[model samples]
Target: MKFNEWTIKDHYPEMALQDIQPISLRAYSLLNRNISALGPNEGAINLLGALEMLEALDYHFINFTQIEKGESPINQKHEAVAYLNRLGQLYFFTKSRFTKKYIPDSESHMPKVIEFISIRHKNTAHRSLDSPQKEPDEYRDRQAFTFLGATTRKFLGNEQYVFPNYNKDTNETEWFYFTPAIDHPIIMEQSYNLIEKIIKELLNNL
Candidate 1:
């Protein structure tokens, strides 16, 4: 669906009345119509950024859904990255706009949300070297290798070899790697729920 067609009331019927409705309408108006009264201020800029990121989240989520339905792993992987990037941006934007009271230290969703953000950060945004000490346990000891030209053999896809190191002191494996995994549809559903919560809270604050 187009971004303009993504109405707040459709997803959140409870926000259709009272203070929330007006704020929601105004934000959309500023975004869609470029209203002058809402412009030329930090609040307007942040609100616009949040709304744009919200649109981006929906855009990537729909693309991921469509690609998954097509049953293509390669394309699905690319779309998943796109979706995660947008999700991270929205999460950070929400955090920036609200106080700790709104997002809180003990929020249940924070860990998963941070995982999603970290995936984008380490893999796509910055492209880390998979350091054992700095990277998470699952992302450590990774080496990307591709078999593009082999005279005697052929490989279907590139491989990332992971060397897990045993730490005697901890009595556990210290290094390992797994392809960054995310259940796109489930996470997207959670993201939509999160966006709704953020919008409600933001409007109430406004």
Candidate 2:
């Protein structure tokens, strides 16, 4: 495939709110940079950057609204599930009220994506003082992630929104999927859309 390109709008999508969180800002930044730096030497580094980028995006984002209210969870899995729950809540409340489907469920990743991210966070994102698992193969080679149906979702008439096509016979959304380099966009898109959704809610409702 050819290198990805971005338009002016892609680079600057309706200037972010004054009080936007760092997680959202960071994700947009990574996506912009990675998309721009698609080349031989740079692409690999950008991919790794994208990997670490999503760790922060998901880790910090899962805490977005809940953190200030003291509703944050200690475990990554809990935080992730909470994030998905909030998304579903928002969709239910807003979708019927608004004429437009402004926030596509496609933007959000299946919650089980947290399992892949949590490990990456430990290995690279956090880089613990205790012990972090660092192996050459993890980065040098493509990695695979498989998630069960519990964390997956497939909305009818929404096939156009799905990213990273899945095999119909052995779909993770149905049962499980194993694929590499799948975490960044999933985490980034949900965080990106969530931030926009929050801002819109404030502007339209408040």
Candidate 3:
């Protein structure tokens, strides 16, 4: 929630070997700035609220791993990754809506979240491997999947995760969902405040 102090560490736990991706960080900064600047516009405010909620869900993933424990190192990492996967679902919703409004015709409007994860894993694994004969362990892949599952849950509910079409409208829909392994809290109060701010600014400018 505190945008200024936020870091990738606050979301991705299993990826402890490195820092947050520059692209993601930039994305967050831009989203935050946009939200603040356009806070007075009703439509824009709603979008900003969604964005913040999504960001918080992600930030929670990073915070979850900060908990120290006496459990096996493998177990700790596995749990962290599980949460990461659950939290990732938020990106799906945000991507879907944003694309529908901004780039409706683009087939790839939805963010390639899994692809991003795969790239992250591949890069990290390759960097850690010593030689051509060495390959990243399969267990590491499992761990990354664990985090991914967590992200999905945080954003989508069980029904949505189990069957995305269950509550969805038929036809060309801009919204898509991932698995429901995570739980994202909807901060209506903060959302409303943001909305009010945007409305005020827009009215003042007009």
The best candidate in terms of TM-score: 1
| lDDT per residue as tens, model 3, 14-130 | 443124342233333444434444443435433445545445544544455454565444443344444335334433433455434443432232234443333223322333233
Per-residue lDDT of model 2, residues 1-206, tens digit only: 22243321133445553333444454454344444444222223323333344444455344432454344223333444344343333233333323134344522433434433333333223323333234333322222221111222334421111112222355322222322224334544554554345334333432
In model 2, the worst 10-residue window by lDDT is: 157-166
- Stretches of model 1 off by over 4 angstroms after superposition: 1-44, 68-72, 97-102, 105-111, 130-206
Instruction: Give the winner by lDDT.
Output: 1
* lDDT minimum window of 10 residues, candidate 1: 143-152
User: Worst 10-residue stretch by lDDT in candidate 3?
Assistant: 159-168
TM-score of 1: 0.47
lDDT value, candidate 3, whole model:
0.36
Could you tell me the TM-score of candidate 2?
Answer: 0.25
